[model samples]
Target: MNISIHSFTLKLRDPFRISYESRNEQEALVIQLSDTNQQGQTVTGLGESTANNYYQVSIERMQKEVALVRERIEEYSLANEVLNAGQVGTPGHLWQQLQPELQHSSFTLCAIDVAAHDLYGKKVGQPLYKLWGLNPADAPTTNYTLGIDSIEVMIRKMQAKPWPIYKIKLGTPEDLAIVRELRKHTNAVFRVDANCAWGVDETIENAQELKKLGVEFIEQPLKADNWDGMKEVYQHSALPLIADESCIVEDDVAKCAGHFHGINIKLTKCGGITPARRMIREAQRHNMKVMIGCMTESTIGISAIAHLSPLLNYVDMDGALLLAEDIATGVTITTDGVHFPDENGTGVQLLTPSPTSLV
Candidate 1:
């Protein structure tokens, strides 16, 4: 594994606020795993994990973790090991091989895993979705996120980009007012994400009102750890609930089965696309709605999610759309839907040269 970590900052076009914090920019990290393919062409896989204040995952911490595993990673590249695409266990094998070290941060592991998937796809000369035997036509249209802001600003955001669906962030005394006001503008399908801000009673009440206003679902309304509250809300809430903060890993998929109407799998949070594929299958087995969301990352990360979209009921890969600028080129997501690049391996390429690549 010739691990090359590129660090950058992704600036948001608007200052995005959720329940936990507000930010104008996100610190981003891109992981590229390079190895020679059978044709003697140097191929690299791409993955991204951004700094998150809520999760306390910073670029420095991820870098340190990467440093710890550099030797083992390079050893694989030195052996010229060819990563096989279409095998679900490819990333799992990597996780086990890295062992005690890669476990330090899911963020670091996410970058490496994503890169490995991309590398594998490139090796086999196939896009990931095609390799997985998925049809792009089955993929759902992703919702554009309107982060928490003053009602006026939020409305402007909606006007700027009219989408088929909008995921509104809410965590305020005027939560209803915000949605009510935004609802007046467009007939777009609404999905509210409370970011674990409301209590059980508040969530139930809000769901009733939101359902009336055409809200398709409510996401993470109560705190993540409030399983008891979730149970009550699950029983009584008018709108279907989707778990975000509550569902972090494959195990959480089972836990969220009865509690939430669905589960939202985030690659960055769950250690990238490898486990995410398993999580999606598990959620499907549970008959729960499956969704995959992206952190405020670049096309590299969002494209990773895009390839897996055929398996999801809903998708929130709008993270790259929220950015003022992206660090790379990969997928194109417009109001029409996500369009994959013709290139294989997530189809990602950095705009600038990597001066910080570590051998």
Candidate 2:
């Protein structure tokens, strides 16, 4: 077994902004794991992780963490030990073994977990979604994002694309105004994300106006840990609240029952598909809506998450769609939603030199 890490940079199609920060470009890491057989056949699995400064994991830091894990893999192999993937085992077991060593960096763990799933699926000659017996018809239409900008700019950006659902980024002084203006342009269903901008009272006030403007849901109205504030808004607001920063993993799913109507699961946030699936089930068990979101990543990451879209109620996995350039091929976005290729595993292929020959 062998693991290779490659760092890549992605430029955004437009300046991406949330409530707290903005960026023109993003740097991410791709991890590829493979094994050689007696016939010299090498099969590879690919995964990606975005180095989001908002998460306090910079590209440099993410690179270092992946290198550290790769070093550990080398050590284990030198001792002739059978690691989880070496024996066609589950990602959960590999996660448990690496959790202690990785210091619970969900981003790092996600890369490995996704790569393992990709490899396992390829070995079994099926995509991960098929392996899990998921139905693609169950997938909801993904929302195209309209980040915070001037009214004219926002309108222009919105007009540039055609989508059935649009997720608008709020947190500006003109939050409601932005929605009201955009509302005149398209009758498409809307989802608003505040990115932890408003106070409890303000959130409730904004929700009322947003509902009138035809918004479907409001995401992370207050600060992540502001449970009391969230509950206050949840009780008063007209719109359903979706937890973003507040819901990190499966453990946080049950806690969202009182404060939020739903939880947004990001692969990196929950440590890849293994825990992400668990998080989805946990959220459903608590009777809450489940959404799969993403950082601005490439097709490698978004494609990995797409495999699980069949199990989700909402999807915000347009990270790769927002990129100016993507070095891989995987999911395709349409008015209906994201569509995967017919290839096996995660159904993703790199456009560069290829992950299989990275060694």
Model 1, 195-300: lDDT tens per residue? Answer: 9999989998889999999999999998899998899999998989999999997788899978999999999888888788889989899999999998888898
Distance from true position, residue 47, model 2, in Å?
0.5
**How much lDDT does candidate 2 score?**
0.82
**Highest-scoring model, TM-score:** 1
lDDT of 2 at 350: 84
Candidate 1: count the clashes: 1
lDDT of 1 at 224: 93
TM-score, each model?
Answer: 0.95, 0.93
